[model samples]
Target: MYPGVNMDMEMQNVGSNGSEAAARQMATTTGNGEGHTHRGPQSAETGSLLQAQCNGGSVEMKSDRRVLALRGPQDSTICRMQKELKDVVCWKIPLWMLLLFLLLIMVAIVFITLALCPVFHQDVDEKFDPSTFNISRLFKGNFSLLDLPFSDDLLVPSSNQSRALSRDLQGKLTVVYSSSPALSRYFSKAEVHAFRNGSVVAEYRLTFLMPEQQEEQLRRFTLSREMVYNVLRQSLHQQEDHGTYIDPLSLTLV
Candidate 1:
């Protein structure tokens, strides 16, 4: 308390006042707060951290003392959150692209499959002619009525199928055309009777005359060679006792 005091006295005075000064500082502060007291110049690490967090304002992490002191404020939290989000999206981008690629592939496959529907052979049309009959050619070609790559015989005509040829004939696949004016080169009647063992149990026919007005009418038929193939095939189903009367359209689209 006195001026010009000796060093020892000054030291003793400081020690005595220390306790009172601490109590007064305490009275000036609010003890109910969660964080610890901040009296001295904070370390660089803690100061910078606090300022950065303060820039983004405060946040209450469960309103705990430990959280306020350790976690600091919201800016660092937002920065950390942003970093984590960036990491997650970076990893997710490839997966998103992969899923998109897979979906595209599936769509392409479906489109291609629908486009190739006629490849399984659309229908059978046959013609029989004793005069222009060719036994060897018709039997050798695909037995399938569908243009698809399969055994032609597998496609059993629907119940409404008409038959023109007899059980008596057998034939092969051959190109038949001539300038004789009596017979064009495209197709001929199949004299299946030439074979003793071979026989015609059933016949099939597909409608080929495209609708006058329809989308892809000519395209569909021509795409499968159905137009020309059906013409000659129609004649074979017209055989005597073959019952050319087509039953009700068995496989009606509608």
Candidate 2:
């Protein structure tokens, strides 16, 4: 062989052997215990330069290096963050605290159900009882009977003149007076006066049937007109003496 050709071949073989040895050294130094590879600063720069020269361009090498540099640090940071989050989430809550939280949730649910559900609402409307409400107000001059619930059943006097007394002393009579226009035509002035004074000639007797064990029992009561008048007079006097009206139904007549 020619001396010049022999020198050229020797130089080429030395260059290839040097490149292979450098690659092997880099691979060995950058390997992790788990057999994964990482790039050290020196090895990464040298490898990129060598790759750029072999591939005939610096642009591809620079792009690849930038991508590797960004991907490696970002992925490692993200994985570490995920592991920390998992560790935090694995921590157990105390039994007492968990029960307390559940109890609070149950209470909230009950309150929401009560506020939003219509099933618990009362269906019966409140009724106005005339026995409990004002009754003496009807006797007042400016009072209108139209506002009363029992206005249709009451009778008003036609004339303001008193009636003559009956000759029969033992004969009992019924007298009713009301402010209702429909029944007023049937009443005399004397009857209206008696009603206002809480007195009437009529007497009444009441009876009650009560269930006792498996059988029913009868109880009788005899209420005279004078006794009824006395109770009414006393109730009216009490209403006048005190500013408050008493409920007639609350009185135990039996």
Candidate 3:
């Protein structure tokens, strides 16, 4: 071999033997309970790298916390907006539903008013009908009287010879006379005295029948007998004065 080559070969052999010896010493120290006691350059470098990684992790955790904190306000805003929208929706009503609700309220108010209010009933009086009265049919009956004038020639002489006169006057009025001797005494005496004086005296008991159910007319008939006598006397006087008589058929009492 050449000298240079021999020198290079020796250097390589020395390097290999040094590395082997260092590995053997490390293994022996680990076996003898001296592991992790010696801090080498590699261990120090590895510790620095691990500390940098831990600092990066802490920075990322702080950024995450900042993001979560910022998101809290956004979340609250969104919740508030949603609540407002729900409130608006709850207040809204359809037109048909609103109208129906108003109608129901009106009906309930009417029902309550009807239940509380009072009701009244009124009565009416019947009216009187004057056309139902028949005057001709009422006077068609037999009645008793005496001492009415028949004619100038037919004069009654005595109480025993007094006759009951049944005569229809003017085809509508009927005059009747009852023959009672006791009732005719005063009229007979008056007739005899009037015959001596050359004048005829006439007297009468008169009753009028009316075609009505009125109590007022019956009351007048019962209370005012002089009124009837005056009316007859006036008629007879008018007949004597004018030589004309009013028709009894056309006369109406009421």
Candidate 4:
């Protein structure tokens, strides 16, 4: 009985030892599997972080390139020139318009002033006067002679002498010789004859007696129709019953 008991106890002890070793080996295998899983996740996270850093660096490089392009010298100069040109155009247009408006205003003022006031005026003292002339010889007789009494100072030849007549009857004149010293020294003669239809004498001959020595000068003298009209008009204006004033400057020849 004692030997059987000893063999059973030894078998029990050996089984117990084998079970404990198996349990320890299984725990070590489970611990190794957990460590491998943790390592796999950490490596994947590191790789992802590296890729993100590369993308960020590429974006920053692109932004730097864009900033460098905008800061170039030629582009900056062009922008400044465009700005200055716009400012000049904005100022110059109004300036030119203002100048033109001022010029137009000056022109208008000049025209208005000229129209309001004249620089020349007519004189009253230089009016024509013919109160002392005889004018009845134009319609009197067939050979009636009318005499004109002119001032001696006006008829005497002197320096700056200017004289005119209203007729050219030198070739048709009948020469009459007179011996009057007053007539020779002072007065000249002019004769006017009026005809009817180029045949008969209409009224008479009017004569102004002058010196015989002045006959050569009288032959060359001629007068315009305006002078004749002036004389007639002045004579008519100075009539005894009907006197009127006439402005000499108002007479126009043409």
lDDT of each: 0.39, 0.36, 0.39, 0.39
The residue-level lDDT of candidate 4 at 134 comes to: 29
The digit string of per-residue lDDT tens for model 1 on 1-254 reads 55656877978989989989998778667543423454334533344333224445554443223355344456678887666545533445654455567899999999999989978655433233334422222222212221122223323332222222232122321222122122343234433221111122233222222223332543454323544445345543543343222222221110
Give one digit per residue, the lDDT tens place, for model 3 in 1-254. Answer: 59999999999999999999999998998966755776667766555422123311321223223332123455667777666545532258545456668899999999988876744333232234435433321111112222333453335433232332212222112111112221211111111111111222222223333336754664465224444434433453344323223333233232
Task: Give the best candidate by TM-score.
Answer: 4
Clash counts per candidate, in order, are 41, 2, 2, 1
Report the alpha-carbon TM-score of model 4 versus the true structure. 0.20
Which is better, 1 or 4, measured by lDDT?
Answer: 4
Error of 2 at 74 (Å): 12
User: What TM-score does prediction 1 earn?
Assistant: 0.19
Each model's TM-score, in the order given?
0.19, 0.18, 0.19, 0.20
lDDT of 4 at 206: 31
Error at 104, model 3, angstroms: 59
Per-residue C-alpha lDDT of model 2 across residues 1-254, encoded as one tens digit per residue: 59999999999999999999999988776665324455566766666533232222223335344542123455667777666544533247554555567899999999999887876675452222323322111111111111113221122333222121111111111222223222222222221221122222211222211223212111111123344334443443444323223333333332
* Global fold similarity of model 3 (TM-score): 0.19
Worst 10 residues of 3 by lDDT: 188-197
Who is ahead in lDDT, 1 or 2?
1
Error of 2 at 16 (Å): 37
Comparing 2 and 4 by lDDT, which wins? 4
